[model samples]
Target: MASPAGQFHPWRHIITFLVITAALYALVFFTPGSTAPKLGIDLQGGTRVTLLAKTTNGTTPSRDSMNLARDIMERRVNGSGVAGAQVQIDGSNQLVITVPGQNNLEGLTRSAQLNIRPVVARWANPAFVAQAPVTTAPSTTGPAASPSATATGTSGAASTAPSSPATATAQNEATTPATGSSTVTTASSGQGLRGEAAALLPKAASTTDASTTTTASSPSSPPPTTPATATPTGTTGTAATPTAPATVEPPASVFPAGSNPGVLTQPAGSDEAAFTTWETAAKAYANGGGPTCAQIEYFQGLDVPDKPLLACDQNGQFVYLLAQTLIPGTQISDATSGFDTQGGHGWIINVTFKADGFKTWSSYTTAHYDRTGGTNPPPDSMTAFTLDSQVLSAPVINEPITTPGTQVSGSFTQQSAKSLADSLKFGALPLAFDRQESQQVSAELGFQYLKAGLIAGGIGLLLVVVYCLVYYRLLGLITILSLFLSGGLVYAVMVLLGRWIGLSLDMAGIAGLIIAIGITADSFVVYFERIKDEVREGRTFRSSVPRGWKRAKRTILSADAVSFLSAAILYLLAVGDVKGFAFTLGLSTILDLVVVFLVTHPLVALTSKADLFSHPVWSGLGNVARAGQEHRAVAARLQSKEA
Candidate 1:
């Protein structure tokens, strides 16, 4: 068998290419934004919210809605600064949002209702639209109802011009308060004001009010049918059925708008009318709507400008509007939630249930669905849920929802549900979170980590170089070159990932990159040692290259495979900064395999032809190691044959 002295000549191009690729990635990173890459939250600051999605309509939310929600949240996060934030969806409807704090926290919370709409000259929504709109004439609403309230439009902007009475009336329907007990205030009812088409549709069908009539004899109230049936996480389910999938024909264009984003299956006009009709009927289903389904429940954004709202409650279900979060001084730190408590999952906002809240909830539902037909429900049975707000599952309310401070179960995820409850229970925001996790972030901490990484990496490199020289002697240069090739490739990947995926080199990540150096060198070690072993066994350079490869490949594959598996497992399980470490570790492991196969082996094959192996001084290995039995016995035997 011949030695691998110069069997392959083309490998030089590959090593050069890898080095250049690494160089380009370094260029991409370390540049300014626009030209450079972005960082992650830990390196920056901001609020991160995890929302669990509950399909209000009994089906899973569509991919489009989920993506749109993520996009909208990102917009809200980025709107704070040119330093963009990230919003991504995990699982089905679960969203993870990260925004840089940049010293403004309330600004971040206000962006929470990213799903709210912006339409009409006024904040014309398909919501309550009721009450004596503080600007309008006095209704029988509580005295707290004022006529001089300012109203924000659907887009969350103050309307440019004052709306006409009819316009005000229309816009008022859409304006509801934040969804907290402390935030709920009184307003007049706005149910009967909707178009005739909406009223007629529900009249076409009727449900039994048997649940209400039998309440006196029933031992326990039946629970509402929640779309989320305690299903295990990661379980894929079938699609949902629309409550009132419109059978009506599409209008060509131009119809009275409702809350549903015109992005419907049919034309916007048809969807709009259907939503309006649905709104009217759904309102009836809530408490203000009818006795059987009077009250409707919803989570609202407090910043909506309108005041003393008259909501639409067409059915007999209880209707709720999210009041604003509690004010600071009004909250008590030691407060707790009780079943009798009207606020959050179990928080009391410390404020009394004001009269205004009563009028807003009860009046709307009473006006629409107070009348009962023996055990039979009225013709208009509403399918109650929020228009665009991230509605958890809205259960079918088969009975009148009456009681002060009752809990509205949206069947939300623990996080989102808690957030809604927290907003309601603790309405005040004295220390708005500009940052979810903040550190001193002095030059001391960053520099300390940086200096430590440099020291560790330097020590590692020094050891590899020293060991190579002590053993391989002339061949040590080749070992050093191979190390550089792998390092260059790893560096390139880090820079590219930072640009595309917001990766950072914290302490853990640096540790990962440093650890990879040994793994990479080990591959080269296996090959180098095998070559020396073969040479001593009497093989020539050409044959040893492939022969050495055959012996080394097994060890290389086994070692790399273990490293790759560890990285994959860590990446899946670890959260926060640890993920960065796992990612880098995994990436470097892959690159090491590539470098060993492509650069290290090829260079060795080419260098073998330079006559260094036959000479004592120029070979890439030391005198004692390379000068073993292969030098004396093999050279003597071959010389005799030649003679």
Candidate 2:
């Protein structure tokens, strides 16, 4: 009997699948940076660096700490403005960082703690003043602190500060805030921050002019009210101290916004002991003839926000006495690097603060702005932005920044700006990491693995196809087409996912795909066997197709559900390559369901209606179809005898 009109449209399902497949293929070939699926580090030439977590107490790190470290490391990698970088935790104490191509992983494991402190005092670096300090005995010399401070305060400008010369022409344009969820764009040009954030640009000059800036050996002419002691000392540890008080007086300490005026001291709980320690270090470096700038170990315990820090600038040109952190890096919500074209700033990093941070920043800037000496702000007005133990910049508060964000501007290249921005954006890791092993994977080796995986997959597919053809005959043609369509859709999906979510295919992922071949074939066998059962019950091939599908779908769905659940469990419990395998397995299982329902069954139904394809021998149902015919003949003869 002819099928009821409009009950089911096999052509509609087939056409829809065709359209979707065509669109996916078009995107794969035509979309920029999405031409192919991303390959894992194991399949692409790269460097693998394994880092072991180190706790302060020399004990094993906890699982929660390790997991948090992994998350932060992943964020750092993403922030590095690099593509195809992977961070996976191994066991409970190790993290494996993989970067594709020739990219380096230096400094990736740093704690990356960022602190913003007020500058107490600044002077020329003693090491630079005394050229003969190199010959001095280690004990006699000051601490050989790492290069940390930048001479110019705030690398460029506070996020709300006026754009400098480079961006002066574009000053008329509004500087929009880039939030964590939004795409970063050039505030002036309103274009994506690709050149500024994604890729490295030209390097900027490292040196700042020495004339306009004051040095330890050369003091700027002070105003009439300035203190007499405010003068630079030569290369000795006896650097001059500025007349202004070194510490923020209680009752007027930097407090949170909307706090009671009666409340004194910063929220960091700076105590007299911390101040005494800071004073000792500062006095010894100054008149006490203590360790000079070069002898101060800035990296040791400088991250303590409650204590004052003594450190040197990156160029070793200036040493700074910084107060306790005014705005912790943790309060920063977003940081993006972009060029300030109209402001003439080469490259600047814009930092957006959280709600509390915004109010604190506003109050701090307002207080300092009021203390400015006419056009130039005093050292007390400067704020030092430090990453780890190094001072990145100490820019002066030019104005009371009531804005929600601020930018760090300086002599920066695209690469340096992006690096700083990424660090600030990702925040600090909970624990420190020491690199235990680092190795480079050669392209030749990756190629070998890729070839082997392909060969294995190809062989598996061939075996499945051969089995189907031998057992099902002409019906096997339907199976072949279904597999082809399924593979095509999966391939296209992988490419799209690679572009969108940074999914990469590895050796284990290939194993998952190979297994999918078996999965798809199993569905085919189940459905075909159901149709054979219907034929054995004396139903015609045309009627058996739809009825068989109804019964087989439930079984196929149950089996696929089990497989998917297993993959999901494995994905959650496993790490590294095992997770990749689970991910691909789950993805393939879902696609199998789609193919069986929309592509496979529809084709079978259409074929059953054709005379040539439905013949018992040609249909690969010779015995079953013949038995159904015999049963029907017997039933008709019985009816005739009864009449």
Candidate 3:
């Protein structure tokens, strides 16, 4: 039978270490693609963009707001699968973003300003219309002669108009003119007010003489005392010029007419007379042939949140007349990507609003939707969602979204839906950001830095190997082999972590690994020194190995525990590249304990039984003092204890 001290089963520990090492190697090699840890921006070239925030009030943003924006931007970047992206606030109003690999910089930098507003009117972009071939012949007279006219004719005149057969038929059903009244007819139900058909209604009415009159009235001005009329003499004759009516000024309740360019108010009543007049004036000013860019800029400069806005979609293919803001983007509390299973509309962004947002949304929808519980709602009952002054979507409010919130469905792919959801979930930045700089870091520079780091690490590791061999001599072989095993295990763990958790390795992380070499060596030295002390006190080398391990294990564990605790604290508090250093340090510290107990201690214990350890010089324990004064002293103490 084996002696009690010898029965530690050291071979079992060796087997366990070998098995674990083999398993880790298999995992590292078997993982598809590159098994190396992912590299960060400092080690791998990537794009960097700097943004300067522009506050509405022209003042610097608060530090808290900038930090909040940075955090939100980080979440958005990470959620988009760009892991290890760096977003930092520079000064009070600047943000610097660095991301690895090729990414959508435009999407990353979007303002994501979500605004919900009522749809007053919508028209096909004139540019888009002009690009398509004109199929219908031009009308000879009346509203058809002028693109600026805002009248949809009564049933009789609607037939003679140059509008397509489908348009006339749709308009006839949607609008009904009051009998004997020359005023243009409009749908009382919001659902019926939609598209070109609604816009054509006012133009259609221009065919009648009485309906063509422009009213000039405001809150301060009394109603027109006498109606001015224009009379045409021939079938295509020019109208007899009538006396000009008084200049009608906009009500003070909205714009003061000349206060700002393009500022307009929502017209009241179901007739939509005021909306038609404003639409006509806006189209003439916006679509005039001077310069589309200049026109758009002028309109954008004058956009007011509480007033109606005339803006185009991002593609500029459609223009929308948007009502006052109902709910601002700040009210959006959360957003997520989902599929519209019921409608088979592919992907969509689900938005949740806060309590105040819910109340605002509920009130708006209740006002726009048919409260009579009717099946068909009005077409004008829709709300448009805008980002950066461009309309993203305009969905009709079928019912009040009183639950969590509503969904924004569009012609969206999975990526686009997720991107939009990420933007909305993060909420809008407190201020708009202008791109200050955009540049790409070349891979060559990153590779050069990486090479330098690797060289430094290699040199440090080499010095450690030389020192161990010089000091411990034959025993250093065990330390060297243990280090080799620990290195393999640590590398495999890094690769696995990168594959599973998107952990990226950078220069700082390499420094952490280099530091671990020293830490790991210390544990071996402690164990070996403990064994040397035991031998000097007269215990045989074979018994001293096991006795030394028990004494040294506690010290090893305590030191490693402190190192791990410090690393944990650093990782939790640090940001940017420093986090990489802390994480690697903590990970390597754990693996060091595994290697020490399993590989290093067992090998030392088993080797103590060999003839090499019998000689103090060969065992690297110095003079053992066998049968000398130290041994006699130890023997005397043993005898006294037995007595």
Q: What's each prediction's clash count? A: 89, 34, 19
In order, what lDDT does every prediction score?
Answer: 0.42, 0.62, 0.61
Q: How many clashing residue pairs, candidate 3?
A: 19
Q: At residue 127, what lDDT does model 2 achieve?
A: 43
Q: Which of 2 and 3 is ahead in lDDT?
A: 2
Task: Tell me the TM-score of model 3.
Answer: 0.53
Compare the candidates by TM-score and give the number of the best one.
2
Q: What does the lDDT read for residue 293 in candidate 3? A: 20
Least well predicted 10-residue stretch by lDDT in candidate 3? 178-187
Q: What is the C-alpha RMSD of each candidate to the true structure, in Å?
A: 21.4, 13.3, 15.6
lDDT of model 3 at position 409: 53
Tens-place lDDT digits, model 2, residues 351-426: 8889998798778877774242223335556677776655656554545665676656555667667776777788
Write down the RMSD of candidate 1 (Cα, Å): 21.4
Q: Which stretches in model 3 have alpha-carbon errors above 4 Å?
A: 1-104, 133-305, 312-317, 334-352, 358-375, 379-381, 398-427, 430-437, 441-448, 459-505, 517-565, 571-576, 586-642
Please identify model 2 stretches exceeding 4 Å from their true place.
1-7, 32-45, 48-101, 106-110, 114-302, 307-427, 430-439, 443-449, 496-502, 537-540, 631-643
TM-score of 1: 0.42
Listed in order, each prediction's TM-score against the native is 0.42, 0.56, 0.53
lDDT of 1 by residue, 1-643 (tens): 7859765554565756666765676576555433422333444344555565544244566777777655555544443222335567778656666553332223334323211111101111222222112121112223322344332222111121111111121221212222221111111222221111111122211111101111111213222111111111232231111122123422422121232222211112234455455344334433222211111112122222221111212121112222111112122222112222222323221222334543443443444442332222332322222222222212122233243332333223333433443344333321111123322222224445567777999999999999988777767777898788778766666656554334555666777889988888888788888887777676666567778878898989999999999998998786555766787788889988877777777777776766865454656543434577657877899999999
User: Between 1 and 3, whose TM-score is larger?
Assistant: 3
